[model samples]
Target chain A: MQGGWHRYKEGVMTGVALVAVGGVLQAVVGRIDWSRAAFPVNLLLLVLFLAGLGGMHTFRSKVGLFDRLGRLPASVSALGWVMGVTVLMGCIRQTPSHLLSDGVEVWPDFSRMLSSWSFVLLYVWMTVVLGLVILRRIYPFRWSKIPFLLHHVGLFVVMVTATLGSSDRKCLRMTLVLGELGRFAWSETDRRSVELPWTVELKEFVLDEYPPVLVLMDKETGKALPAEAPLRWVLEAGVEQGGFTDWDLKIVRSIPEAVPVAEEGRLDFVASRSVGAVYAVCLEAVHRKTKVRKEGWVSGGSFMFLGELLELDEHVCVAMMDREPRRFASRVVLNGGNGVRKEGVMEVNRPLEQDGWGMYLLGYDNAKGRWSDGCVVGLVYDPWQPYIYAGILFMMAGAVCLFVMAQSGKWKEETV
Target chain B: MSWDYFVYFAVVALAAWGAGALWAWRGRQVGWVYVFTLSGLAVFLGFILSLWVSLERPPMRTMGETRLWYSFFLPLGGLITYVRWKYKWILSFSFVLSLMFICINLLHPEMHSKTLMPALQSPWFAPHVIVYMFAYAMLGVAAVMAVCLLWLKKGNPGEREMTLCDNLVYVGLAFMTLGMLFGAVWAKEAWGHYWSWDPKETWAVATWFGYLIYVHYRLEVHSDCRKSLIILLVSFALLQMCWYGINYLPSARETSVHTYNLN
Candidate 1:
């Protein structure tokens, strides 16, 4: 019982120390903001956690430090756990279209790509400390298994590389309209355009743009339901037409205690996929008199009262996934590609690269339209490619060595 | 001369592979196979780089260059995997895979040669592909091991299979671990955080976790049935998604750092 107690204590202490080490390493790596209370407070917690773990483990002395080491490996294990699934980390922030649509709070934020100040500081910190710690060696030290060593070493290199990537790399974008192509994308902005390291003529850009997706809504009540798209929208209903479809009012289930309504008579549209009944929507008598335009077409999430102009500036576009609808765009894509040269509006998803830095297709100029052509660029600088390669090499070498050892009759003979 | 040159490179690679395979089939001489594999790599390394560099435009931005890069991945992978030990016909396999892929690309003349779009203009594209492919190749090696293990269980542990599988698994694990790191680093620079939980991201992490569990099991249980199966299953499935499954997801079209071709 006494021995068991000692072992438990050792285990707890080791776990605490590992966590502390990891947290400190994180801080040193710049994952925390030293200026803020969080980092400093976290540092205190690190100390306490470490002390707690240490005290918990070392309180009983039946087991030595060596035996308690593996528990700490769990921290590294956790680190691996966090890093393995990378898609969850949204580096780029995408603003949803203004047009009323379903909420998407769970969606990844693309804003991470910009690398905020806190991020940059943490990146620098992570780089320097990760480098030192990797080379210097931490608590559990042994080169018995090359794969094991390489794995840890590789992770360190990766961390450093990521930090370098933040500072060194840049991104940009250029657009093509159908058959258009170009040898270069764009520079920091429209005024400056950088040629590609290699030339590429656009062979083709398959629009594959599907027909407009539609959502049906009632005339009196704004209860929306899904419907076949590209329908002729009649906003105003005739006085006699209100019989078929009832206004699906989202009545508040609240009692007398609830806050009073802010305003009445104006119904906020509620979205639904399908409704049991269809409503008749007739054009308003006076509204039909002037056929200049109507703004009732909901596109790319932006509902525009349609104008009479046949060519709508903002076209509804969707980027879908898993049969579920994703984000929609209602911006005009001005393909500035002319003969051999190509250019266009850049969005976060779209980017152009020239020289070495990449340019994101931020947005386009509305006033100048396609005629006023320019590209916005995001630049990146990376110098630690060699280090990355080295890390990969070492890690791989270690793995090979370990694998060979496993096959060397030593491992099998002993284990079997 | 150009025709002769193309034929020469192709023949050289093929010959090296054939010889290596024959030897593996014979007695599984890893060293000889390594030498032959590397010889082929040495022969094609420059050619491959030259081919990549020779593009008059951002060849990678086009579907063809993507195919070409994938093709190059095998040889490049063979070159790396053989750094310490040679697996049976590993180099040859990479060469053949690359050649086959590139040849298929050639069949589609319309998709040939395109310049980088503003999005593809990012220098990250090359490294991203390179690192990811190497990771793929490494995993390919691992898959070979997994196949061999099954074969071994069937009492068909050909000497070549054992050596190759064992070596490849090691190499693959290393590459995967490194790939995970590189990806994170790249993302941190490209995005802010090191890891995200997108489907692809989820699968990548799952792959890593699978490997981690494998490694952990190796240290603790040392290759239990449950662990091995879990590891193998996760590795293969995640790999499949990484290669093809994720792309099919309609959500994949969403703008992401991991998004390819769309840029």
Candidate 2:
């Protein structure tokens, strides 16, 4: 029992010593420049790391520490340390590297935990422990160990590939304007414009917006009425009705596309699909307490007009809020530099893959809404994603085994 | 279909669950307990189905919508646990916890809308969210079991009860793993990256690690009942942060894409 306690204490000291070395290295060398380890460098490092791990496992009988580190105490300590660092990572606000150049004041090391040498070293230590665990189980393995192997090896693959392959992953953005051929894209990492192999021209942009909503606004503060838990009624042309806070409201008429018109000293809206058209609604509101009625045409307005509201009283009025976009897509014609042409629609959550690149719709001009003629597309090329998916599959299989084992009471109970 | 009729469905489901709990506590007519519990599930599921149809999409977008799933799963978990372990008190505990969520929903209803954003219109949305809700329900049951086995039972829990709690955690972790993987795959398909280390993702990993430590400690190290039970409660607290505590964190509020537009 004394020997066992001493070994556990030694294992914890080793873990703490590793952390100290990491902190010292972090202070000396600054953050790890991952881009410096791209491609062959990462591959070489991985090979060396594995070779060392295998050598350690083979010499476990010779080195007392190797056998000790392979035991549960060391593994648990490593996991506990990882958990501690991860908790710290969650608490700190980690900024993306590209955004670091924006001149915002942030903690030097913690702000970029992913790139900090201490964080990287801690993960490397974890991988080493995990590698030893996997090696221990691999020798003289039975079918019963398959689930354990899957879980550990799967995690190992994900950690190794995601870390090393991150440097090779490329994310860039391209903008396509209607009727204009575009080939240049802005790389997110290095912040430079690069010409693409293919050109894309936006043929049409479609934006489907949800119907505008009406909120009772305080005429003085110009904010939603009732201050807390403000009520909103979605306008659906003569179909929906609701009451809120002493006011019964109804949509008398609605127009999806309309422009303001003035004729015979009366301001009204005419339905049109012309430029700068806005969503206009006719509302009738009744004050339940006072038995007073108010009616008028109101609009959330567009780039061309300031919105109009119906005065319910001196204190409050019925105001229209801007229509929220439900979905937006850009129809584009892609021309490969080699004379191949293809047409596709790119939308959020729907990426068009072509020539080893995924093109995802990122943004449109919020000011122009549906009338915007251009859209930003994010292009990404990640070769390591397939390996990551394989790892995910292995972990999923192991998880299934765990579930089944737990449910059937087949787990081998350790004697207490 | 809408929250307007939620009170009726809530009351009916509560009555069925309450009756099932009473029947379970009496330790008589197991068939009647199953009947009552299943009827409650069916009625609640029917309401969800109607809401899904009326909304023209899965009702998994808002905080209130997720609560609807939580309430449904709590009793469902209770029934499954009772079926597996024959725990008479499980139903009463789940029903009371589930009732609290139902009451909250009834009092503070959100605006009902049929508009689903473009980013949410993925095939992965429903399964990802539903699986997570189920996982949360299972873990919640484990936490309640921990509380009972620790405090209420005066830390003298039977081995069978302890094993049952462990098994619940196993099931919960299994589903949580799947849910996180699904989210990662969907994120890769939707966005450019699989994992962005966003605040929500960070908290989720912390939560996963917390439970992992408990599982390892219980399985390999000493199975001190008190220590394991305490670990369970701590892990549950981490899960709470991953669930809704991120919304209130200033660091998370601006950065997390997982934040639901609650209003």
Candidate 3:
């Protein structure tokens, strides 16, 4: 029993030493500015570092103490405990308590909770345990073990990079006025003014909107029937509605920008102001049974008058509506102080990345246009992004490998 | 083609498929049910194809549009599971769930426009959503299996059903992992951050972890069937929250960038 206790103590010490070495190596790598290095050099350095670590882990695992620490029943139990707790905490963070409150109002603040020493210790412990398990299980790697190795290693690298490089992550919101040079940003968190390395001279901001669509609605039932074609095509085709009410609707004329005009006591459409210009469509609806016809001009946003209730039958009343601006996007240019520049369109789902920072089109003043001011952009500097991406590649490759192996019956003999 | 026509055709096909499922359940000629199931799937695919042609874009933008794919894939997943495990009741359960979604789409039709939002214009969108729906369907089947296993505890699952359940969980988990990875990559391209811990993403991770727990429990602990089934049921709840319930969360409703308004 004494000998067993001594062996266990030796294993614990070895595990702790290995973890310390890993932490130091990660810190060293985290301090390196890979962005400043040439692409080939960065690639070579990353490969060499990974190889060194892999070699060290393999060598350590051959030692009985290190190997035993990895295979310990307690380690698996601890991993399960940590994972379960982390998931619970994630769920709690998404709850109303954390979500409804602002950062200042949040009790036991989320960012604080994540950055706490205990949380960090737990995170590091889980990572170290998982790394040890992967290292021991994947040594003298067979084709079957590759998936496990890649996945666990990928996760380890992602966690290490994200945690160690937290201080390097910076996010700021900037309002780039049209044709204005903006060089300063005030960090709300730090409560300090930060001088930007490059001046962002906004060349232009273009916002493009989608074309409007017309639809016919039943006033009583509130059932809308959308037209399949544009105004011009609708005029040519002539839509016929046949369920319960037989009405044939035809577009008489369509104007892109128009205003209501009282011409000879009759409401007519005329070319109007460019801003807030309403799309007007002149429609003629004919009742097939009654042989009665009514004509009206329906302008977008003038739903009250534009939707004159046309009596189709004793039970049916119809009106016209227009659906406009399904989506919009912003195009901007980023001019640097070093005479370097990059131009890109920032639409939803597409952000601009430049020199370790990413500029996202958060929103714009609804009244603004290509020549207008006040476009909100979110600038994020996350140094760990490259590592996260690399981790994703590894995980994806691992998944594909496992899937292919499963399909090929390579895992048929495996139990877990 | 109008939405009315699409709805009418889909309803008729679903009714026929339902009748075929009933016939199969009643121990009639199984081939007829297979044919009807395939026919139903084909009809739904045809409707989706027609919409794609008319819209001039992949019909995967809105909730109604995605429901079309979900409705199709649910049965496809059920059929695969049923074939692999020879579980006769699996198709029936899947059919019912698919029918419910189809009804929801028909009853509350969202505005069907030809416009694709710029964010959804990515190449990753289709595959990401498609794989997720497939994974959801498979997980749904697994949950049903779990429920059956729990209810019929007196009767042990045959070796085949047990294996089928485990394999389904494995495949579903894998697909879920792939979906999360794809979304992360897409997020990096779109939002500039891979993991924002946004409510939706947080719930997604919770769901993933929930299933991971089940995987570990099944593989390492070798727990009893009842315990495993309970874990699967809990994981399924998490999956549901990740899929749609997240939208109702105050955080998601207020601040989530992922909430694609149901309307």
Candidate 4:
């Protein structure tokens, strides 16, 4: 009974009991509806939880369970349960409940682990155990314990606030057509149109793309030729290339923006920077084996036109693929309607902030591609982000301490 | 400056590391080992620097680019371990793994695209990936030590070797924690959520928890070296799944945004 293994057995048994209780509760009552615990309820619950922890600490000597819960055995058992649950989550496919189609239920508990009752219960148990461990260490107040304190406290803050504050988070998509003042947004949660505080007008949607490349594509399979490692030749103006699997190719002329025009007998492309213009390239390909040569025009066409390819033979053809976007930005002006106007550019990963909301460039009309006249922006308001950041900062300091201790060989000395 | 010059740099780095491994194996002076290993690192660094300059962007957007960093950091981690614990055989272990990566790159060079998508063009991109790669290398060295202790050590290894193993895991876990946190912060700035339980993120957290269990297990039973070594190996396997195996998993292939576009 005095051995550490005995303590681990007791701790693990306690964990199993908690999980069983959670499962029974889940079966009795369906998934937890988080929206019910929105702002004031969540705040009240947080205060009560802290007070309960303090009471547990104050009465530790009166109860043997409290003391044991603060020990390493309990900590390890709690972490093991958490790890097991997380691993199960990784193995099973997860989808947000809202995204699933109507009346489709597949492995309900394992599929949506985040919203399941068992996961919430397990996390609550871990939080309580971790809080007790921190309290036990803080009372002694050794300078060396700062790192441990930081790591535990940081993790506690992140877990508590992120879960509690999730119900209060609001995310919506705002669409702005060209030169039009838009004031409505589609809520991601309910898919309903909601009025916004400000009106947005899109000034311009600029898209910069990489130069299109020509590839030898198989006529039958439609995959790039050679199948394994297809060779791509960049179509640049006045550029020439050869050594493409017994074929020599040269770019005779290239136009960034062009439109096809029928003149007399043959169709020719002339440069025109219009909204629906596509990239057109004129190239000459010579077959090395037979000395046969072919020349024509090819274009990675737009929504209104089909892409043109130069057939080398019945087996393969030289074609231009659609250019990949290098960068896309939406320049917009926002008006709050009372002498408050803001102008900025929003791009992916570079969100614009205003009035405690972050606006990110989400999508554009894919069918129109670069000629899209409207863009969709995602708006998010997360009040608890600051608290999460504070936790991350503390963890960063703890990590530095961990690195220094390991590098200086202090950990080995202390552990041994 | 381009991938065309990768073969030359790989050859030079392999030769220098090979000489260092030989010198260490022959039980020669420790100072010479540092000279040859560092010479190899410097040569590899030169190629990466030139490529970064020529591409006008960081060379960390593709699978092949990540391999370059892995090869560079493996030997550097080995040197750090040797300096701290005076374990000379660590060089041989790290160099062999490094050589394997270099050979893979030589056999099949990935397409080197100069363009990066809008979502990947963030300031956090470089540090998040670089830190993760470094952490992987450190954990890999610890895994190698675990294998040696489990199989090769005659019987009942002494406390010194176990201490070395523990030290490596501690450092590796620290770096891993930093890398995950950095990724979370980046995700928030880019996508508006700190964590969405994406398949890749789920696997990553599972790996972190796997290592945490090992650390606690070691603390609980210092006498049971066999169980602890097995735990370390299992944690390493989870790390591999987190790193690249997620790309192949059917559950992750459709929903995961972290998959590398091979095109």
Candidate 5:
């Protein structure tokens, strides 16, 4: 009895230490905003503190209620219930179209439902039951307990962190115009405008396009043929198109930007270094049956057709230009109210993080290519990110431990 | 390599898988079964490698591209299970499932463009997808084993069968956990949020929780084989939804960043 008492005291101390560590981590991670009374952090601390103390054998031995609640059947049933409800919610959220058609706002409605009193009660009840079951099962930890502890504890930590951090999480869309400071963002939940703590000035916006390709099309049917040529093909002195059509077309020259010039009473093409320019291809075509040769410049947004009758030939031969935007990015300078300044490049999949805020390049003005007016960025402020990351790390470590323990062949010798 | 070459290799690989299944059924020398199956896997891997080399990127960008890896891993997983448990019918079931995916690829060939979108050109893209596909393969095998257990005489599965099923679930769950963690980490880097609650993500978490419940149920209840089998089957269906069924969700089509423009 004396030895059991000593062990119980040690467990209690350990539990207290664990909860204390969690509280300190929360404070350090900014999860506990003291300015707001840190209610969420305090609530989490209280819950963990109670859980830690209850995990002690001394406390557990004094309370018959925990033992009764720790019944395996009850825990399993509670888990099933939670999983069922969560899945149902998830299924409903998966059909956004249905929700929209039903006049239900997806995220807000889902969030409201999750935070509703009934849902909260259910969530808390199941969490408590599950936690008790895990605590009871893991009290006398052995090698075999590693997998169970990792999986369950990791899950509990993640869910708790997510819940505690939800109210502090904020997402907004910010549009930055070139050469102008942007200090306002539209809330993602609602389109209401909100002022940000920092000003973002777009230094420049760049759009990169893939190499242009020339496509052959049947003007009559308006159907594209399979024949395609790269921009390099324009540089070639001549090229044959017999495989694509009955006409044989030869490229005379190509220019990135072409402007027409009248030389000797005939039209000629010359390269122009203009801000807004179109790709131009000068070609010579020979009719297969008539053996007549013709030459002209076919610029992007300009049409050229070849045939016996001008109108009839217009339906027989056509050329189309195509190019896809490969990537877009924004160079921006962020000026914070705290007098901190930073410069960063924001691109898709590469976000700019500064002073607890992340700015992601969502898109750019499609009509203006390299000279776009500005870019659209999504700004996110999540105080719970550190906790979430910690939870992920813990979960990953737990998973690895379980996997390694299983492979070490020691688990088979220990009976659950 | 071109789609034509892919088709040729796929046909040959499927033929080999069929022959291996025949040998397994006949109770022929295990060496011949190993030879046929391993050769099939080799050919399949070669096809993937060729496509990767030709495309100048990992063949994990498109739905059909990822399906190629799934087709390969499913049989590989079944072969491993068969070798471990000496289960005769495992390879045949794996072959049929693999054939279905291969046929899907043949019927609806997607654009095999050489260019990968900037978002897909990340270091995490390959491992995140590869691990998920491997986990799916393991779970697929587990589901097959559960079905076999369910069909046993009087629905009474022997201890050996139960152990096999449990072991499969354990390994599959570990892989699933790893895959999910990798994906979350990748998403944090690319999308600025670790958990967006996207439709695919929601389904994935639901599937994970479903399996979690199954594990707890098996441990706590000491349930009968039929009940366990049902749980596994249901978990497998959730896995399917997480994998591709989410694509059919209209909300996902509009809002999910993960959707693949297969057309």
Candidate 6:
């Protein structure tokens, strides 16, 4: 068992099989996510990744492949890889068109997610068994080292906590204001309702503000074209040192149009003034004679043209404008997460409770008048807050223990 | 404390980085050189970040806080690596990364700051974001180590470093996995769902899987493990793409709660 292949077949393989059995049992009856087709889809792709590498034969044939290919020579290489990867994912995340096309609507609230039996199953299996199996195979059941023993014990703690404390819970979406506390209605009529213990009210809520973030792009990369600057709205305006004087640069806004957010708020408006880069666009113009042309920055309406907006994805447009700045009806923005009773009173974060339910502050709709003002809040009534907290604590402890052990192996080597 | 002065900070950082790079070219005691250069550079950038935070009215609600994140990750990531390895050359990398983040942040400074909306005033938020960022810095290093170990293993056909490298990869994966799980738990507290199919969430899953691949790769160390290393590198890269990419895609953006309108 020099490389431990024999031990793996006898001990680790069977252990893995036992873990798989647990997964299978749970997949059938434990949780919804694992049972569903999506879980298999995830696994299948993973399997394919392994298959592409020629399976165990290839893995076992090479020694120290990890040391060579797992990392770059220096930290800069690592950062470069990370940056390259970040940009790649960013492109995927910010698709020019929706990956799932054809006006695919969200499944109305989080039902598709929370109530997903398939996801629950897969999540449970992954959390409890796969992670443990991997750990056990690596560290085994031996209580030889302190770090090793702690790790083994820690994994057990995480499992107990996730399971006993708060594995099953649900929430609802609500719209409310400060003084006018309301009730939470469940999305599915069949689902059981949870009621809050107190008559709560949202006193006030505020969006933590930040400064205009600077963005840089390579001149050659399509990320930022000096030759073809987009019609950029002022997402923000700030004064910073430039050369000798503090140069005031206005950040162009770029808000991707998302529906769940829009639907939650009956009324919505782009931050016309400049909260952040809510929207931006890149355009190409033909020069008078040369192929090159002058590209200047302007909002969609910053210039006069029926220019098409650059839709970052099918759903949201990082373009000229979402909807031209319109006068909101309410002076007090009633966000889904905020509650307001009038100009004098405000509510947010705190729920406005009434009846047998609580109305949480989810978000607010930009408005110009009384009728237009709107807000949305996520509502939940967990009878297991304390249990959940306990479980979280256990999970954190287990995780922290696991982390410390992994980092302190060198220390262990010295001690041994 | 002006943001403009910080631009100079970036220049200084780059100079330090370049100097360190030059030192590396000369094959001298570069780790301390790298550390001193980056430490000074990051502190300068951090000072600017403090100034930005103290602004009477910050204009940083959008992805516009690019420079701020730069200041944040560079010094932060640099400090973390310095603490872990204390290697001089490694410190040089920190300076380089911090400068990169700063440069990127400066590029989009015009569009980020926004007025405080009603929802963002919660005390839990800053801590959440700050912890998450630091964790990311730590995990980022781990991911890098994983890649480096794998690559080195590949270069040395039957070197003794392979097992140790595998161990390092495992270590990184463990930390990152924990961080991902922690983030999910935090989400449950802040929002309701412990898991959302937001782009960030999905990509996080992918990243975790990448870690799993490394684990499996460890088991098969006596075999062709280059593929596994490639997977780790690829997966880590995907993590970056996911963070920046999902913002542009409208469907993912429309459904996701994590972005806070980053796109």
DockQ of each: 0.06, 0.55, 0.32, 0.59, 0.36, 0.20
How would you encode candidate 4's per-residue C-alpha lDDT over A74-122 as one tens digit per residue? 8778887887788778777776766763333342466778877777787
Q: Would candidate 5 be rated incorrect, acceptable, medium or high by CAPRI criteria?
A: acceptable
lDDT for each residue of candidate 2 in B94-150, tens digit (9 for 90 to 100): 999999999999888777777787888999999899988998999999999999988
Cα deviation in Å at residue B68, candidate 5?
0.5
Docking class of 1: incorrect
| CA lDDT of each prediction against the hidden true structure | 0.42, 0.83, 0.64, 0.83, 0.69, 0.43
Task: Give candidate 1's chain B TM-score.
Answer: 0.69
Docking class of 3: acceptable
Query: lDDT tens digits, residues A68-91, model 2?
Result: 667666766677777777777777
Best by DockQ: 4
For candidate 1, lDDT tens digit of each residue in A1-416? 24212423543453345445544554455233222433345446446644544553454256443222323233323333333323333222323322222344222212331122333333333233333333334335554534445655775665555443334433334543333444455532223566554433333221112222222333333333222111222122222221112121111221111111124752223223231111112121112333333222122221111111111113321111111111111122323335344433334444344343343334333332222233223344334446666765665565455545654544323221
Give candidate 5's root-mean-square deviation (CA, Å).
8.7
Q: Cα lDDT for residue A338, model 4? A: 81
Can you write out model 6's per-residue Cα lDDT over B1-263, one digit (the tens) per residue? 54546566666656755665456446577575556556565656566566557543332334545346434554455444545554344444555555566666667544222245444445445544544455455445545555556654346333333444444454455455555656665565445545545667766655655555454444443444555456556666655645566666654666566655333
In Å, residue B241's CA in model 5 sits off its true spot by 1.6
Provide the TM-score of chain B versus the true chain B for each model in turn: 0.69, 0.98, 0.92, 0.96, 0.95, 0.70
Give the TM-score comparing model 6 with the true structure, all chains together.
0.56
Alpha-carbon deviation at B37 in model 2, angstroms? 1.5
Across A53-165, the per-residue lDDT of candidate 5 in tens digits comes to 46743465677655645554545555555556556655664432212323443222333335333334345555666567667778677766766666667777777767666
User: Stretches of candidate 6 above 4 Å error?
Assistant: A1-124, A127-170, A173-184, A188-359, A368-377, A410-416, B1-3, B24-35, B54-103, B106-109, B112-116, B138-154, B157-190, B212-228, B248-251, B261-263
**TM-score winner between candidates 4 and 5:** 4
Candidate 3: tens digits of C-alpha lDDT, residues A276-308: 456676767787788788777765444222433
Instruction: Give the winner by TM-score.
Output: 4
> Could you give the candidate ranking by TM-score, starting with the highest?
4, 2, 5, 3, 6, 1
**Fraction of native contacts under 8 Å reproduced by each candidate:** 0.11, 0.57, 0.32, 0.55, 0.38, 0.15
Chain A of candidate 1: what's the TM-score?
A: 0.33
Off by over 4 Å in 2: A1-11, A101-108, A221-229, A237-245, A264-266, A412-416
Which run of 10 residues does model 3 chain B get worst, by summed lDDT? B216-225
The DockQ-based CAPRI class assigned to model 4 is medium
DockQ of 6: 0.20
